[model samples]
Target chain A: MDLFIQLTLTGLTNGAILAMAALGFVLIFKASDVINFAQGEFLLIGAYVTFAMLAQLGLHWTLGLLLTLGVAVALGVAVERLVLRPMIGEPIISVIMVTIGLSSLLKALVSAIWGNQPKAFPPFIPSQPVKILGATVGEDRLWAIVIAIFMLGIFSVFFRRSREGIAMRAVADDQQAALSMGISVKKIFAWAWSIAAATAAIGGALVANIVGVGPELAGFGLRVFPVVILGGLDSIPGAIIGGVVIGLLEAYTGGYIGQGLNQVLPFIVLILILMIRPYGLFGQEIIERV
Target chain B: MLTLNNIEVIYNEVILVLKGMSLQVPEGKIVGLLGSNGAGKSTTLKAISGLLKPEDGEVTDGSIKFMGEAIHHKDAAEIVRMGIFQVMEGRRVFEHLTAEENLLAGGYTRRERDLSSDLEMVYSYFPRLKERRHQTAGYLSGGEQQMLAIGRALMAQPRLMLLDEPSLGLAPMLVLEIFGIIKRINQEQGTTILLVEQNANLTLGVADYAYIMENGRIVLEGYPEDLRQNADVREFYLGLTEVGQRKSYRDVKHYKRRKRWLS
Candidate 1:
């Protein structure tokens, strides 16, 4: 029972972080129909930039977090303006290829600046153990869960209730129709890119807070694919649930079944989902009434 | 309020769609532009609304002036902000969004933060939309989606509303219902409308003045009463032949194309 409790808490923490990362992926995909391959690189940049501020520059962690987010937003806007904007009206496959190129470029830039070694992250969220529900959990892990849920909640509300959020969704549904309504597709694309970056940065920061920042941190982003696939690609709630499910599965497999199989478990689920439910558990069915 | 002066549109630098299409829409009145398929009716509205840019269509010559300003250079959002909203053909509502959210999106350019009054105004115009407000717009019936599209236009509170075939793909009765509301929207809000449609009979019924076009140019223009009495309109558009009319198949083919008017 104690082992189960410990595994569940750890799983929830990882799931929350996965949810944060997938949130941005869904946003960009929903708004622009671009499958951003660089989303993982975004995580690397976020982790490295924050590490630079907190460790090398000796800035306070809060200020470091803010500056990292600012950098993320700028990165997002610049990418959309410079790379994606010109590709408008191009074949969707070509547009997707551009994103793959972008991921490579960003990854190269990060290593060029930060080097190939992992750096110990500044102790922002203390890793001191905490007791919760009769199970011991790392303090950073608990905070990660809290911060992830908070970020996800704010965005869920934003998309559901805010005017601009609704406009963004409208563009996702139909670009020409949204334009006719005076919703600028260009502006919405910019917003999607920027916000997606900000969320991924937060997710990156959370993961860094737990594990030290490194070039290998990008590998953490690859794990997000299973979450996004399990969740509907465009559904925010789906991302949240999928994150938790994948996280719990990973924790259980590692805790009980074995060590190596845990890492491979998400891919197995991804294959099962693709074969059984291509749209994901909560994805839109792509059916149009008229 | 809106005037297009000999505007020629070329798509992909070739495939000329609109050849010197010219028309004028006066303030506070309904102006109907009647044309068959491929006569550049939809393209004309796209030119006025600046939706042409997206489709690689350009207004290469002449100018479009709205409210006495040269607007040919402006884009769609700028034109919309200047108080001209277009209800695009085929009722292109955001399928995933709820009906109410689609309307809120139309209010994107409005200066005021509070939109309850505008939403209420739209609901008053189309009560059916308010009932289906929470329903996903894609799942709505064809007629209901058309209403939502028109309601979206109204949410913008546009001064000059350009409607492209509001009656397309609906029952005759629903078309009549939509036309009645359109006339009401114009009269009540003093919103000038440039209506482009192939339904000449219904358009002529609602329009104060009308223009008939063929091959991307206006072939006839007059008050509805005058256009209704025109022999060409009666024979071709209204399908009304005179008593003891002896029109042959050749005449029928000629009436369909009506190339004599181009001269």
Candidate 2:
């Protein structure tokens, strides 16, 4: 019972972080129909920038987080304006290739600036463990889960009630229809990028606190891909549910099945989901009739 | 008032579609643009509404002035802000949105205006839209979709509404019903309208003035009654033959080959 409770708490923490990362991926894909392969790089940059502010400059944790988010938003907007804007009408394959190329470029840039070695992430959250349902878990992991859920709740309300949020949904529904209704499709695209960056930054910072900052942080992007695919690329709620399911699967498999099995389980689930239900659990089935 | 002067349009910088087409739509009048398929009627509407640029098409020459100011360089959103809205061909509603939300989207440019009243006003015009206000627009029948499309446009409080092929693919009774509502919208709102259609009989019935276009240029222009009385227009557009004429196919082909409009 203790082992099961411990694994469940750990799974929840990891799932929360994965949900945050997948939220960014889903937002970009939903709004612009671009599979942003550079999403992981956004998280890497966020983690490193936050680490630099806190560890190197000895800034307060709150100030470091704010600065990291600011930089993330600016980076997102700049990337959209400079790289993605010109590729708007290009073929889908070319756009995907551009994003793939962007991911490599970002990884190389981060390595050049910070060096290839891993740097210790200074402890911002307290190191004490919290007892939950008779199972002790790291306080930072508990905090991360709370923060991720909080952000998800905020985004759900924003997408549901906010005027700009509805406009974004309208654009996703039909670009020409949105444009005809006087909604600026360009503005919505920029908003989507910025929002994705901001969420990824929070996820990155939290993950860096768990594991030391390094180029390996970019691997989180690859890991989150399966989560988003499992959830439904365009469904926000699906991201959360998929994240938790994958997290639990990993925790159980890693606990009992063997070493390295947790890492491989998500992809297996992804392939199975793709074959059985291509749209994911909650994705809207796109029906196109001639 | 809107005026197009010797405007020329080309697709992909080649293949000229509109060749020196010029027309004037006076304020507070419903002007019909009548043409057969491939005659550039829809292209003209697109040029006026500034939707041509996105399709790899551009108005290559001349100027379009809306309310006596040159608006040829403005984008679609900018033109919409200037109080001209186009109901695109084929009823392009946001299929995923409810009818009410679709109407709200029409008021996107005019965010400061009270939308609830406009929603009520739209419902008043098309009561069917009111009944299906909560239903997703994709599920609505063809005629209801057309009403929703027009109602969505009216929510913008447009000074000029450009409707393209409003009667296309609809049954005759539904076409008349929609046309009746179109006329009522113009009369009640005093909104100037530029209506494009291939349904000459119905268009002429409601239009205050009519322009007949062929091969991207205006071939004839007059009041509806004048066009209705003309023997050529009656025979070709209205499908009415001269008394006991029974013209042979050869004669009809010869007449088309050497049309007076071509001269």
Candidate 3:
């Protein structure tokens, strides 16, 4: 029972991180139909920005976090305008390739400035351990989980209740109809990209605290793809559930099944789920005619 | 209040979907566009709404003036902002949003005003939509989605409304109900409409002016009464038996009169 508890808690912690990242990924995809390959780079860039604000500028962690999210949003908008906007009417493959290229370009650029080395992340939450149900947990992990859930909750409200959110959803459903209804799809696209970037930034910074900040922070973007697919690409709840499931699977595999299996489980599950339910768990199924 | 003058749309520089299709919707009038399949009725609507670019022809070949100003080259978004909206052929409501949200999207351009009264008005036109306001639009039946689509457009407070086949995929009773609402909208709101329909009976019943399109061109044009009386239109559309039989105008007129009495 203790082992199960330990595994569950540990999995919940990791799931929280994946959930945050996957939320951003799904937001962009749901609103714009663009599979953003550069999402991981946004996370990595955000972490490095927070590092720069803290270490170089001597700013408080709180200020650095806010600055990081803001910069990340700006970066997202820039990328949408410079890369995604021009490729709007292009072939889907072309759009996907452009994002892939953008991610690589961002990686190279970040490495050039940050020197491709892992850096220590200072604890945003105090270095205190909290004992819950006879299991000890770090304050940062608790903070990370709390913040992740809060952010996701806030986003859920924004997507459900806000005018811009509804407008963004309209654009996603039918661009032409959206335009007819006086919804600016371009503006919605920018908002989706910016919001996704902001979420990624926070998720990256949180993950950096859990595992030391590094260029590999961006790699979480790729890891999120499977989670999103499992959840249902367009379904917000699916993203959260998919993230938690993947996180638990990873935790169990690392704890008992083996670390190698941990890496392979998500991919295997992703393929199987896609074959069975192409739309993801909560996603609307699409029927295509030849 | 709307005009499409010499609008030419070519697909890939080869397939001419619309060739010099000119049309007009006078202020506060419902203009019905009738056509067989592949007759470019929908394409003309698309061109007017700025969903397609006319590279092979010119809107300036004459001039497409809306409210006395040429709006031919304006973008779709800009055109919508100028109080022109389309209820597309399929009633493309946002599947994920509730009927109310779909209506809210119509008032996307109207940010400051309270939308409740407008909502109330839309409900008056489509009571079923009011009942299903909280339900996702995708779950609505075909007739309900049509009401939602029209309700959404009404929320935009358009000066000119373009309805593309409002009666498509509907039962005859629902068709009458939709046409009734459309007539009410024109009579009550005085919103000018350009209606594109495959159902000639419904079109003739609702429109003041009518245009008959064939092979990407307007083949016949007249007032609804004139169109109802035209021999060519009667022969082609009113109904013709394909057997080796010849019919005179008098016989066709008598048949139409009898049918009208029965209807």
Q: Compare the candidates by TM-score and give the number of the best one.
A: 1
**lDDT tens per residue, model 2, A112-228:** 989999988997887578898899998989888888888889888877656677677778888776777677888888999999999999999998998879999999899887898
Q: What lDDT score goes with residue A87 in model 3? A: 74
Ranking by lDDT: 1, 2, 3
Cα lDDT, all candidates = 0.90, 0.88, 0.83
* Winner by lDDT: 1
The residue-by-residue lDDT of candidate 2 on B1-263, one tens digit each, is 99999999999988999999999999999999998899999999889888887788899899999989998888888989999999989998777678887888888888674678888999998888989989887788889988988988998899999999989788999999999999999999999999999999999999999999999889999999999998778877887777767877766774445556666
Ranking by DockQ: 1, 2, 3
Q: Would candidate 2 be rated incorrect, acceptable, medium or high by CAPRI criteria? A: medium
- Per-prediction DockQ comes to 0.82, 0.57, 0.44
Q: Write the per-residue lDDT of candidate 1 for residues A112-164, one digit (tens) a residue.
A: 99898888887788999999889999899988888877877898899998888
- Candidate 1 residue pairs that clash: none
Q: What is the DockQ (computed on Cα atoms) for candidate 3?
A: 0.44
Candidate 2 regions exceeding 4 Å error are A288-290, B243-257
CAPRI-style grade of the A/B interface in model 1 = high
Docking outcome class, model 3: acceptable
Evaluated on CA atoms against the true complex, candidate 2 attains a DockQ of: 0.57
2 versus 3: better DockQ goes to: 2
